[model samples]
Target: MFNINYKSQHPIYEQIIDQTVLFLMEGVLQGGDKLPSVRELATSLGVNPNTVQKAYGELERRGYTENIVGKGTFISSSHQVEKDLAHQFKESLKEIFYEMSRVGFNSDYIQQIVISVLKEEEYVTDTKS
Candidate 1:
């Protein structure tokens, strides 16, 4: 289930990769889960086949998926944490926090905002991140 947003500044291939990672993180997709063919996904998302291929290529390079000849692509059997994605996510958060600080948002205020969002999203349970 890919959600493509043409109006967003983000590229479609990156969105596909992001959503795939989210699915893995949320346990909606697990080790050995089969992914649609690039052609199928491209047709479904109304994107170029090369776009889907690029996304899948990046995912494989990050060790998130495996492509076996004739069998098709699948989620990695080990399903280990994607280090590149984690690093990039942390770096992006750092940039956001820096921007927030420049705008007068203190650490405590930012923490509160994070806590509120986590709680509202049902990701909090009396424990802080």
Candidate 2:
């Protein structure tokens, strides 16, 4: 369900975390679905089982998943994924805005850019329909 890029600056476990989140956000992995075994996933991905275990541990800590002994890891349904996605988006936006400011972009220009993108997204959605 995920492809690892060895050349990427990010760690393998981090990539797993990212892809798992994306899968949940995309509805490719539903709540209550059991994730593959660590050994299984590690063998498939050609990474150490420790890596998958670490990723699973982090996911559980972050409330993205729950581990059931003797059963396995499953996606958590306690939290609304859409709400979580919005929160993540907001955090990412803040980081991007900070970087933009560091690069000399003014708040007004950033606001304009964001507004323009929203408009373009709306136009694209309209065209698709």
Candidate 3:
């Protein structure tokens, strides 16, 4: 369902996750769709099956997918996907914020860093709110 670049600094599993998420957001892969099995995808991409498995595991963990025993993985239904992902991103941010906090960065520092990063993006404007 996605292409892989072996030479990219990003990890293979993460690349898979990113491409899959992009596909979902871009309407290239629809909800309720079945993704290739781990073996099929790994063989096609010429990567270790564990890599594909890791990607799929992350996708499942992130609320983008659900795996049914004996049936493989499927994207969440369109109706429920938005709601599921809404909280998921917040949960991810919480984890990141917690990690950054442990390193002595408080919420204000984190907000400034986020705003700075947003300001650096050409398409972003007025990130302060």
TM-score of each: 0.66, 0.70, 0.63
Error of 1 at 67 (Å): 0.5
Q: Count the backbone clashes (under 3 Å) in each candidate.
A: 0, 0, 0
Q: Model 3: how far is 21 from its true place, Å?
A: 0.5
Candidate whose TM-score is highest: 2
Compose the digit string of candidate 2's lDDT tens values, residues 24-94: 87889988999999999999999999999999999999888999999999999876666788898899999
lDDT score for residue 20 of model 1: 95
For candidate 2, what is the TM-score?
0.70
Cα-based lDDT for every prediction: 0.89, 0.90, 0.87
lDDT of 3 by residue, 1-129 (tens): 578989999999999999888787678888889999999999999999999999999988877889999999998775556775566678888999999999999889999988887888855887655
Arranged by lDDT, best first = 2, 1, 3
lDDT of 1 by residue, 2-106 (tens): 898999999999999999998986788888899999999999999999999999999989889999999999999762555645776798889999999999999
Instruction: Quote the lDDT for 69 in model 1.
Output: 93
Q: Which prediction has more favorable TM-score, 1 or 3?
A: 1
Q: How much is 35 displaced in model 2, in angstroms?
A: 0.8
Candidate 1 Cα outliers beyond 4 Å, as residue runs:
82-129
